[model samples]
Target: MTQPQRDCVIAGGGPAGMMLGYLLARAGLAVTVVEKHADFFRDFRGDTVHPSTITLLAELGLREKFLALPVTQLCTLDAVVEGERMTLVDFGVLRAPDNFLVLAPQWDFLDFLAQEARTLPGFDLQMDTEAIGLLRAPLDQDAGREDAQGTDSAGDVLGLRVRSAGGDQQIHARLTVAADGRTSALREAAGLRAVESGVPIDVLWFSLPKPSEPPPATLAYVSSAGMVLTIDRGDTYQSGLIIKKGAFPAMQQTGITEFRTRLVAAAPVLAGVADTLTEWEQIKLLTVQINRLLRWHRPGFIAIGDAAHAMSPMFGVGVNYAIQDAVALANAITPQLRQGVVPERTLAGVQARRERPVKVMQAIQGRGHRVIARATVGQRVLSLGAVRLLRLGSPVLRRILARVVGVGLLPEHVRTPPGGSR
Candidate 1:
């Protein structure tokens, strides 16, 4: 059986792929997104929704619907540095209305996008479907054909060869996109490799029930013992202890009691419920990484989000950045996709537009990793010099951090018109 060639076939149904699928379908382009996972529900996922993404929801007329889902709005990221508490990031400093960081489960966010996309006639999402390989065909062009025609049958990537419960099938399309995330099978199959930046921290993730009188939900505790990030998830607290890279095995030998003690030392507020972490089964190790591909595109294919750049869990901007990539790609490619084939230059332009922002964020995260690693080495991360600088430039610091964390480096708005082809 032959599948109808679509305007686009995205390899991963993640943040970038789903959003791009939604935007493209809204623009009247046929798109099929395949995800290996049967569902979006997963443990210990990034939960931060930045302010620019919040603005995007409003642009798509999805603000109310997205807000209706369970979410916590964080106006400030409070950090306790060397026993001194200070607000490291102030979302309040950003322009009103869009100001605030939203804490939402990554599953809910992905589900929301999938649901919205399905309503579009051109959108098709397939869960439990994995891209096993790429479909490539040498350019066979006619000189008289236009750019959107045979000219961009272009090179190599024709679509994706995927596998599901029904077995193997081919999704042939004008263009293919790899949004499969870090360790992406599609990216690897494309022979693309990301250049890795060494990260000093690895994180241990677990959740604890809220205490009767739990302290106010903040961002992190940066103490000499180690850094502990606590995310507010309504009734429970999603927390991660930042430890030295490849140190989980040694940390395990010290026993769970020692782990609890160390976590409590970093975040005193968690002292009440820290003892509840009795078994090692409850903890999961997330080896932190920051990496980006030297080339994010091939002839007839392109990569976005973690497929292009794997982000560290620093400011929790990974998901938002991925969505931003989708917006940029959709904005740049929709016109060509509507006509037919998305030209190679257009795909290259999308990568060019997004690469700088990804690099800048990764650099900041790398610096943050170094700063936080000091705590693991028994040194104060927030030295007096830094504290004084922050205090002296308090207003300036708030504005800068708010923009960097909540709004991002280069924010893209939805440009693809809705119901264009629908």
Candidate 2:
């Protein structure tokens, strides 16, 4: 049987793939997005939607509709470092109209995008389709062989070989995009290598019922017990307990009773509901990773978002970065895609445009990891002087921090044409 063809085949239907698919389809390109999961209901995914993303949605004329979904607005980030309460970032001071971050389940956000993309004429999203391998096309029949065996040859990725409920099949496309996230199968199949950094922390995520008198600000408490981050999730408070890398086994051995006590000591806000966690099954472990692919593109394939760079969950920038990548990809290749061809240069252009920001963010996350590791693993108390300095600093300093965390380093705009004919 003949395989189906498209202008672009995007492997993964997360933020990056879905946004890219929407932009391409809006510009009248036939886009097929394949997602391995049957649905987007997975828990513990990043839920912080930054201001940079909101601005892009506004430009696309979907901001109002997007914001209409059930979401909690977080206007500030406060942390209790060494028992000293200090405001770290204030989104209220940002110059942008939508200054605050939105706390909504990732599934709702993806579902909203999927619904919008479905309205377009040429967008096809395939759920339960797992991309297993790359379909490569030879570069030249008589190219000079580089290897001694003369078996190694240059080739371009033509599409993907995917497995679904029906059977395994091939998908042909003018361009193939690997947005399958940190453990990207397409990126691995294309032989792209990611340089990994030693992240000294991992997160244990769980949720508790919302308190009767909820705290006004999202809180990050760093104490002798451990570090804990709690975000208001309307009915429940989503929490992350940061522990030293490879400490989960010891934590498990310590048992749930001791774990609950440690959590309550770290963040007093959870004192009322921490007991709800009776077993290990209630918590999810997120192994933090900070890495980036040295080369984000190979021939006719391009890797974007977490597939290109896996970010640490320090500032909650993963989803925003992914969306930014989608916008960049759309801006760089929509015109070429309209011509029914995506040149290798275009794929390279996307990487060149987005790599610097990834490096900067990774560096910041690395520094943060070191700080947390010292406080948690080394048992050294964080200096209160930095907190005092931030509190005494000018409002401009707070705004700068806000722009860095809330809006990101280099924000991307929506350049692709809104719903229109080719």
The residue ranges of model 1 lying beyond 4 angstroms of the native Cα positions read 138-155
Single out the weakest 10-residue window by summed lDDT for candidate 2.
144-153
Give the Å shift of residue 321 in candidate 1.
0.8
lDDT, model 1 = 0.87
Q: Taking the tens digit of each residue's C-alpha lDDT, what string does model 1 give over 86-196?
A: 787889978889899999999999999999999999999999988988888754665223343213233478899999999899999988999998888877766666789
Tell me the whole-model lDDT of each prediction, alpha carbons only. 0.87, 0.86
| Error of model 1, residue 407, in angstroms | 1.0
Instruction: Tell me the tens digit of each residue's lDDT in model 2 across 282-318.
Output: 9989999999987888667999999999999988999
Which residue pairs clash in candidate 2? none
- Prediction 2 TM-score vs. true: 0.95
